[model samples]
Target: MSAARLASASAATAHQRQWFADLHQEVAAGGDLALVNADAPQEIFRAMGIPYVVNQWWSSIVTAKRRAQDYLGLLRERGYPDDSEQYSSIPLASAFDPDPANAPWGGLPRPTIVLAETTGDASRKIFDIWDTQPGVSFYPLESAAENDVPARWWELMPRDWERAVGSDRLDLMTGELEGLIRFLEQTTGRVFSETRFAEVMDLVNEQQEWNRRTRDLIARARPCPLPVNDSIPSVMIPQWHRGTTWARDAARAFHDEVAERVSTGAAVCSEERARLMWIGRGLWFDLDFYRRFEQSHGAVFVWSMYLAIAADGYLRYGGDPLRALAARFAAFSDQLYTPPWSAEWYVKEARHHGVDGVVHLVSEDARGSYFTTRALEAAGIPVLELHADNVDARSADGDALTRTVGDWLDRRVRAGD
Candidate 1:
């Protein structure tokens, strides 16, 4: 049976749509806009009153609208590799989509400044191409390697962040953030207010606190009150707007809604025989894939990295908001995609949620997927690894994937039940 959609998710979606439309109009009226990577320090933008659209967020919108293939094809025609980091490359390709009328949401407005971290060789090159466009400047932040591996990082991340993320990495990132502020101040002719930045950081921490409570509430609920599809949008839309009171309130509303559902003994699947976790980027092209197994296998995907990371990954409680923000992102990639850290957190979350099985989507661009799989299996949880691109639909075979996962549930997951 289909689960009731969360009202908070619907409201967040509607707000985002209106917000984007207004942003597009403002930019079209000659206002400057920044296009930043998902990992970039968006709080700085929020505090400075600069409008920015996250590259990955827009890429998901383009992919979900069935426009990824056309944009990806444009990349191939221009001698760029179509197979390179599709999540970042899709928006770059969309910039050249000649027909604005056919573009998703009338296409992303030409950004005045593009900001991204040099996460890898391919992603750096992708952002570099954006710089080549007229009136667009690209700023790259250095991604430092994680030297100190901490156990149970989520526990220490909120208050004891200096020890959780090594001091050396934090220092480097703090310097990078300072440089970014200087650059933005020069480009936009807008002053960077330390007071405003601190306020934004406080709001973001508050938003995540509500998310943490909601996550714990859902984990303890039987039969799962919310599906991953609903949770992803509910958490992520507000997450993109993190550092604002609106986002903070939206997060609390989501928590209250989930808490209410749990109190009422609501269930996504009436006969949920299996509680499963989805590891890796969302299946943006086919969200329906999440619900395919609900009827036959009585399995509902209750966990995804979207809400879990929002709960555990973004909190930093310290006096120095700038340094705390730096600490939050210093090894952000490592905490989610590195060996021991990624593996440990996955095992912890799997146990916390009482997950019986995991479907890990091993994307080509993401690192350390195998370690997460091994850790979950070591914890006595079965895992089904699906190798595919999260945003690119051309690489996914939906029907085949459905059959494969169905067979897996029958053989590996529900068989034990």
Candidate 2:
């Protein structure tokens, strides 16, 4: 890796680790903790003054710590497929890890509530394990694949989402969120306040607005001021804290850092030649992969959905705050997975960032990459489809992958194929 990480990223990492420590202490003292899916309506948890762990987020930490394979073995012992959605499954398996001394974040505090949307095939089953655990309540929201795919969802999602994604879909999600609120009320003995939810929505919109500015800045900045490695945490950590004052400030701070770096002519690779876009889930276990090609090939990964999706995907501005929040999560995960939606956005982003090539990680659970790959190629961008799990390092050979990408860049991008 390059020594080019952003300050906001460093602060965010320290804050989250310490925050997790504090959260573990809270749960030990009999406080409530929820384990939620990335696409679940987190703003609701925020409004309820609850601290939660995102399943995939913690799984990344475990995978990075090199303990994922051990936990996967435990899952296999329970007859769960070792290769099945390892990213989301690792945390669940950790509950049965037997060796708590080796688990991530002191072995993810036994969640009081388990929350997830049945977006992928394995999600419901994964959360079910949490539900069956003593005292953990599981709330599974429904995710649908809408046939009516709209163009320019980034603009429509913020306000006209009901029509953009269909009113029926929004209606289902909004009702489910209402049920979630009632569940929280009954479980926590705390009144779910509309006032707090609205305020939280305001904070989220403010955060996304800052993200939009940062994305636009980087999209246009020639020499790409920061590495995608740094941008991932800079944008994503705040994303997990969407409705907080600190998250809002962090967004602004990151945007300012990117702006300052660009103004000062800073560069991740001063000899930047090829700009690339990552078109699937982040390579969490090997984020250093993004920088590996920088010195060797001058191929810099300028865009990943983490920052761009946060820029384009999270805003919703219509009626009731609760409904708007529901609208945000209703198609949240799908926007990056379903056809037309995922393909269109990737196409738009590749063009916007002036990418020379694409490394599309086609995870088994992530749908629509076939079309995504075709669309990018049709738009005259060369793409290398790397079939592997973003979370599981064992799924692909890291050294081989670097060579594959380097060869692709040299043969296709450098030769203008």
- Highest TM-score: give the candidate number: 1
Tell me the tens digit of each residue's lDDT in model 2 across 1-417: 123679999999988999989988999999999988888899999998988989889888888888878888889898988887887888888678677765776788888998988866677788888788888999989876578878788778888978887878878888898899999999988788888988999999999999999999999998889999889889988888889999999999999999999898889998899999988878877878999998888889999989998989998886888778878887887678877888888889899999988999988776877898998999999999998998777889999998999888888998853
My TM-score estimates for the predictions, one after another, are 0.98, 0.97
lDDT against the true structure, per candidate, is 0.90, 0.87
State the weakest 10-residue window (summed lDDT) of model 1: 93-102
Flag regions of model 1 displaced more than 4 Å: none
Question: Candidate 2, which segments miss by more than 4 Å at Cα?
Answer: 1-3
Candidate 1 displacement at residue 27 in angstroms: 0.3
Worst 10 residues of 2 by lDDT: 1-10
Q: Best-fitting candidate, measured by lDDT?
A: 1
lDDT (10s digit) by residue, model 1, range 58-111: 988988887788989999999999987998899898778899666888789999
